[model samples]
Target chain A: MTDSIGFGHHQHACTTNNCTTPLAENIREQVQNHPCYSEQAHHYFARMHVAVAPACNIQCHYCNRKYDCANESRPGVVSELLTPDQAVKKVLVVSSEIPQMSVVGIAGPSDPLANPEKTFATFKELAEKAPDLKLCLSTNGLNLPQYVDQIAQYNINHVTITINCVDPVIGAKIYPWIFWQNRRIKGIKAAEILIEQQQKGLEMLLERQILVKVNSVMIPGINDQHLAEVSKIVKAKGAFLHNIMPLLAKPEHGTFYGLTGQRSPTDSELSALQDSCEGEMKMMRHCRQCRADAVGMLGEDRNQDFTLEKIESATVDYQAAMQKRITVQAQITAQMTEKKEQQPHYVQFIPLTSIKRGLTKQKFVHRPILMAVATKGDNLVNEHFGHAKEFLIYEASHTGVRFLRHVKTDLYCHGDDSCGEGETALQRTIHALTGCEVILCARIGYGPWEALVAAGIQPNNDHPYEPIEEAVEKVYKEMIIAGKLDEPLQQQLGA
Target chain B: MSFTINELCTNCWACEPLCPNQAIYEAKPHFLIDSRRCNECEGDYPDPQCASICPIEGAILDSSGQMLNPPGSLTGIPPEKMSMNKI
Candidate 1:
């Protein structure tokens, strides 16, 4: 938060040895403590990306990094094209394949800040599902100033800002035009606004103690002469690190490269710029500028299909499989609802949506409902669940509850089997999510019985031949009579 | 509301072994949850062994608003539990 600029000493794997190793000190500190970060970290994978700024608004002649939505097998990267669920699944799979994966980064995959919805959603899912994984976002300077507060709330640690040139006069030649406040602005005005926003974003992030890294693309002809100055501006702005990358040119890239057709940065040229950034702003020599969800080495593309692969892998593959599950679930719902409805008058399922609604009804009672046990209903989830469904015998441990029909998890149950399985999963889910501990079941085993006792769950698997709904009501009676539940979990029946 | 594992376990023995539970075991397609034997692990450990060991976050989350562990901090030890936020 101090005004001083910063560049983290932490870097990801720097050698071709493996992209999974932790680089630098900051990440190392976390890595040291993380269960997954030790030498075993080598098993992990790295998914990286370039910023996804659909509209650069400015022109950078040396690079052809921008891409719009197209098919899976395309040249440009996919930006303006992803959903939250898609990103979450990608993080799950990618990190799973290469166990060493410690982070989910959104570097250009579109100026991460510009595509706030896309970026935040992806990170949010990763945080919830894979809290152990770290998150990083890199962006062009355009909208970086806007999302500063959000960065802190999400605990985003590393941010890379692309500052191609600090000199506005030089910047004008590179940027053809820009959209400022809904109006088009030519060269100088665009450059000024951009510089201001970039600086503001950097200052804001530093003040909040988030790591900020500045990236300056070294164009041989255009901003090549402006490297030191650009470095100076960003370093003064409090960038934790500076990455000076050589501009790569491919003639087919587009108008920018076709016209400028400048040569790429030689090895020595890049080294010198890195040296300049080293003294004032710690230089970032390990930048891979990877594609979104890019796996393997930072710079190399090991992905079978980069763009769409990440998205498609997350989609519900068998539409009919989901439909079938939904159909079965509808039946289970009626049965469960009917059972809950039969519970003693004290326990109600009023159909109220939120606590506000229940409070408006002015009725607050501890509806002591029996606890639940979630079974790994999904075929894949079987491994995580050591025991089969046991209402009476439950090993008190957590299990995935796949209430969302679309999501098929590492462990989840589906079908008529899921009715019993899902009910079990749901009961455990209810207790875990709510913290009330009592359950209704047909049977449970001894090992799980003792374990549940240790954790404080009271399992009731004694009922036989009773309507499942009636059995639930009976269980409610036992809890209330035993003083296990004060009233009941309420659902408003009518307005 | 509490959590329990069901049948359908692979007995891959992952969860049971991971369980601070000693609580989990090798069963059918999934694991089982003994209500009499489960407590969301509120006081003993930093995280719910069931959830953490489950290898799934949602697998071991709070049941509705009755959260043993919310999205905030595990240790009420945050300087703010005193409700003061001062050094």
Candidate 2:
């Protein structure tokens, strides 16, 4: 059955040259095209989530499941819920339309395991119908132990378990109750049972050689500091990646934390936590905290384009679509190869003035710097500075330009009339770009250019329409040449 | 009169901080503008801040159910042409 579904063939199909760190060949192959698992792969591949499972056993303080929510883009929110048959149809339509779509994930409006029958039914249908697409699931782990066998039997290779805390005391604060063993369990006891099941399920999946990624919500006051311990434990237990996501506690979400004024972590705070946990495990920083019905590429959401109504009326030629998808993917791979070859080769440039001053003994070390690029996709820095809703952040060093994550920011310019009045918005944009030393955009007006420069962020319009990675590297090299790499960033901005 | 964010808003966080009156607040389906506090940037700016920066064509609306940044205003692409291209 697994062989018929085209499983295990991906074990040797690693094509992208983005993997800098060495990994087992099979492990590399599993994450090669998975957008959520690999940071670099997100640029070239796409994934869609089917909101098939609408039932959850665990009650998390930060989660309030909402259905038919089209406007908001967040976890546990979906514009439409689909039955197993409807889900299969949607996947076929989406895969046909989006050639880069590779993985189909059943991450809830609720937990997938809690709705086992529906979740497995969808997976079973997709495995049989669309044998080429990879299958994955995100679960709360309350019912994970019971479904591990079925998961492996269905060739579900990737599983993400949201494990916030290993200790039941800390877990109690996050999880108010968990429906287990035909009873509604509450408080620390409920947390204990949930924790035990999560550990056991993680171990069971690892034993079966299935890849597991652990996700933890970084609730500021609750279990914020304890996540490092959770990361250490999961890594020791063979979990491949640890994604420490910020708690989305907006008051309007109606979640317990949201109502009680539990604030979410700042971008800097989340980055700091991820950095601290980086030593213990491979930290995933590129997560978009997508909605259950999210579609298309990682940062861009194309859900409105493939609604159920659209798919129900559309017909799919699976064979032709699959062939076309292959051709498009090959083109993308070729483009990536060309871009890789075009990367600026790193060269150590010691300033002649420093050499004359006999400061040659001081090693001219080039530290990695973060740069934010304004782009409207197509892998180019083409978006205007004022028009960017989100900036794709990249870390450039002597090695190469690595995609870090996208930071959503308030727009700085409204229009010609509201030119100099975007002070509050400009301040927020600058604050969101806390650690970034440079901003690369297609064009910039005078007001924002002055504000950005005053905040110590060099706003450059030199790399218009240039490839993102190449532009970032060029900016890094320019900074190196100007001897500005060693100077400490201006502290006046309070970044 | 106050401005409103209709169903077309993608919750991109563009208009939330740009509101000078701090009238916009995050809601379940989308961001909402407080009618009482929303002066439509009358004294603050020449135009409503939220409508000017919104990327989506018909996302932000005026009190009378008219789009502030209507079709072809931001992208200069006609709505008729956009719909014809949709699959």
Error of 1 at B19 (Å): 53
Off by over 4 Å in 1: A1-45, A50-59, A63-81, A305-495, B1-87
- lDDT, residue A34, model 1: 21
Tens-digit lDDT track of model 1 for A1-495: 011011111221123432222244654443321211221121122444433323233334443332332322122255433456655665565555544445667754435664576578777766766665667777767777789888878878777777887667877766644444433455677778887888888898989877776777788878877888877777676665566776655433332544344577765577566655545555555343344535553323445544556645553333343344344434543443353345323223222223234233434343323334322221111111223322211111111011110111112123335334445543353333233265444456676566556667665567633333334444554443454443333552331
Docking class for candidate 2: incorrect
Q: Which candidate is the best by DockQ?
A: 2
Q: Deviation in angstroms for B65 in model 1?
A: 57
Calculate DockQ per candidate and list them: 0.01, 0.01
Query: Which stretches in model 2 have alpha-carbon errors above 4 Å?
Result: A1-21, A66-68, A334-369, A396-402, A410-428, A445-451, A488-495, B1-87
Please write out the lDDT profile of model 2 over residues A290-337, one tens digit for every residue: 889999988778888987789999999988887887788778766755
Clashing residue pairs in candidate 2 (N, C-alpha, C atoms within 3 angstroms): none
